[model samples]
Target: MGIFKIEGGKQLKGQIQPQGAKNEALQILCAVLLTPEKVTIHNIPDIIDVNKLIDLLGNLGVTVEKLASGSYTFQAKTVNLQYLESEAFKQDGRGLRGSIMIVGPLLARFGKGYIPKPGGDKIGRRRLDTHFEGFIKLGATFRYNREDYFYGVEATQLQGTNMLLDEASVTGTANIVMAAVLAKGTTTIYNAACEPYLQQLCNMLNRMGAKIKGIGSNLLTIEGVTSLQGTVHTMLPDMIEIGSWIGLAAMTKSELTITNVNWEYLGQIPNVFRKLGITVEKRGDDIFIPAHKNGYEIQNYIDGSVLTISDAPWPGFTPDLLSIILVVATQARGSVLIHQKMFESRLFFVDKLIDMGAKIILCDPHRAVVIGHDFKSQLKATTMTSPDIRAGVSLLIAALSAKGTSTIHNIEQIDRGYEHIDMRLKAIGAQIERV
Candidate 1:
C-alpha cells in the first residue's frame, strides 16, 4: 500500500546500469530445483518477484544464500516438494506466472507437481493449456480439483516426443523446454517462443548437460539426458529496463546513459523507437541518450500517410513494451496506432492517459490511436494507482511529465520488475519519493 509522490518537469541525467532480467532470473532459479547441486547465479535483480520465488524455493527446502547485492548461491540439495500444500508457499507461488514454471521441473524430477491458479498482470486471458498440453505429451497426467490444478507423472520413464505449441507463450515454452530436457528421448518443439530470455534459459540448461538446438529460433530440439549438473551463469541485463529508460529519457527531455546493455539482444527496440523518432547512440556496451529538445517526428508511410506500431511474436516488436512506447509517443509530434494483438485488455489503461489531457482514441480492447502533444507538457498531476508492471511504468512516465505533484499507490507492483526505481531516478534529478 505504498505510494510514490513525484514532482514533475525535471530533467533526468545520469548513468544507470540495467539490472538482470526478472523473466530470465525466475526460470533459472526454478532450474536449480531440477538438480540437487549448488547453482550460483550472478547479476540477479533485487526485485519483489525474484525475492518471492526465492522464498518459495526456500519453503520447499532449497537453500538460498545471498552472497552479495546482485549474486546468490542456491542449492536444492534436499528439496521437499510437499511444501506446495502449505498456505504460505501456495500464496507466494500464486503471485506470479513464473511460479507455474516450477511445476514442470518438479514433475520431471519428482514425478508430481502441484500448482494453484497463477496471478499476474490482468492484461488478458493467459492460458495454461499450453503447459498442460506439453506435460500430457511427455507422459504426465493432469487433474483439476475444485480449487487447485494437480499434475502427476506416474510413468517410471518419461519419453519425449514432438510438441506443437498452440501459441508461442513465453513462459509456457520455457516450462516445457525445462521438462523435456530430463526426459528419455529426443524432443522437438515447434512454434516455441524465441525471446532472448528463452535463449538464456536454453543456454543455461545446455551448460548443465542438456543439449538444446536452435538457440534463438522458433523450432527447438532438446536431447534428453539422465541428469543435469550444477553450474554458475551470469544473466544478461534487462532489455525491458533498457527500453523503459529510453522512453523515460525521451519524454522528460533528459540526457542518460544505460551501461552494460547487451547490444546484440536489443531485438526490435532500436527499430521500433526509431519509428517514433527517438535516437539511440551505441558506444561499445553502453547506450547514450542526448537531451531531447525538439519533439521526435513519427514515421509516415511511403505514400505520405500515417503509420502504426504493433506487437507480434518474437523477432517482432514485443507486446510487453507497447505500453511504455505508447506513453512516450503521447509526448512526441505525430500520431500512431498501437496494435496489441497478444492481450485484449492491455490497452485499456489509456483511458487514464486520456484523463490526463492526452488525446487518445480507444479503438478496441486491442488497439489505441495516440496523438502526440508536439512537445507540450500540459499534463496535470492526478492521483492514480498502478495496474501492472508495464502500465505502472507508463503511468510513472506520465506522472513525471505532468505539471504538479502526482501520487501513485501500489508501488510494489512497479518494484516487481524495475530495480530500485526511485533511487535510480533520484540520481538523475527526478524528484520521486516513496511513502
Candidate 2:
C-alpha cells in the first residue's frame, strides 16, 4: 500500500527509455519452460508482475541467473515437476494472471500443469476459458476444481488441431501456440493475435527450432517439433508505457524524449495521440514530444462530426492506453470520445478526474466524452486511490499536470506494470516521490 506524493504542474524534460514490453516478457518468460537449454533474455522489465513470475519459476526449480540490470538467463533444465502439486505452487501460481501461461509449456514438455486461479488487475471479468479451450483443442485433458478454484491440464501426447478462436486473444493464442509447437502434427490457428508481442514469441520459437509461419498475420500455422533448443531473445520496448509517456508530455505540457521505442511496432498509438492534437515526432526509433506550450487540440472527424477514439486488436489503438488518452484529452483544445471496448471498469476512473475539475461525462461503462479545459482552468490536485494498473498510471499523469500537490495511494498497482515509475519520473524532472 505505497503512496506517491507529487507536486504537480512542473514541465519535465529528459530521455526516458521504456522498459521491456511487459506483456511480451510474461509470455516469453513462460516459453522458457519449453526448452532445457539456457535461454538468455535482454531488456527484461523490472516490474512486480514480471518479478513475481520469475520467483514462481524459481520456486518450480528453474535456474535463473541475473546477468545485469534488464538482462537475465533462465534454464529450465531438470525442472522439479513435483513442485506443481505443492501448496507453495498453489499460492505462487495464484499471484498473477501470467501464471496461466506456464500451463501450456508445462503440458507440452512435461505431462501435466496445475495452477490456482490466477490473480491480476481488477479491470474486468477476464475469463480463462479461451486458454483452456485452446489447450483442449490440442488434445489436453482439462480439469477444474471449483471448490479450490484450481485448474489442471494434462496430456500424454498432444496432436495438433485447427482452431478458430472466438476472440483474437493474445494470451490465448500464445498459450495454444506454445503447446502446439510440441504437438504431433501441424496446427492452424485462425483469428490468432498478430500483435508485435505475439510475433516476437513466434519469432523466438522459430529461432529455437519450432516451425511457425504467418509471422505477423492473424492466421498462424505451426508444425510440431520434437524438441526446442534455447535461444537468446530481446524484447521490444513497452508500447503501452511509451504511449503513457506521450500522454504525460502533453498533459504536463513538457518536452520529453522517449528513447528506443521501436516506432514501427507502435501501431496507431502515434496517430491516435495526434488525433488528440498532440504532436508525435519520430526521431530515429525514438519519440520526441515537444512542449505543448499552447496546449493540444482534439480533432474532429472528416465529416466534421465528433472524433471517437476506440480500441481494437493489433493495428488498432490499444485499450491499455485509453485511460491515458482520456486524461490527455482533458487538457486538449477540443472534445473526443473514448471507447474502452475491451473492459467495462476502466472508464470508472474518470470520476477521479472530474473531482479534479476536468470536464468529462461517463457515457456508460465503456464510453466517455472528454471536453478539454484548454488550460483555461487547471486540475486541482487531490487525494485518489488507484483502482487498476492503467487507471493508476492515468491518475499519476493527471496528478503530474494538476495545480497542486496530490497524493496517490495504492501505488502498488502502478508498480505492478511500470518499473520504478516514481524514480523514472524523478529522473525526468517530475516531482514524484514514493512515501
Best by TM-score: 2
True-vs-predicted CA distance for residue 282, candidate 2, Å: 1.1
Candidate 1 — worst ten consecutive residues by lDDT sum? 147-156
- Say which candidate scores most in lDDT: 2
Quantify all predictions' global Cα lDDT against the true fold: 0.88, 0.94
Give candidate 1's total backbone clashes: 0
Candidate 2 shows a clash count of 0
Candidate 1's C-alpha runs over 4 A off are 148-155
TM-score of candidate 1 versus the correct structure, residues matched by position: 0.97
Q: Candidate 2: what lDDT?
A: 0.94
- Please, what is the TM-score per model? 0.97, 0.99
lDDT tens per residue, model 1, 50-158: 8888888888999999999999999988978667766777677678777889988887788777788887788889998998889889888787765464433434566
Q: Please provide the root mean square deviation of candidate 2 (C-alpha atoms, Å).
A: 0.8
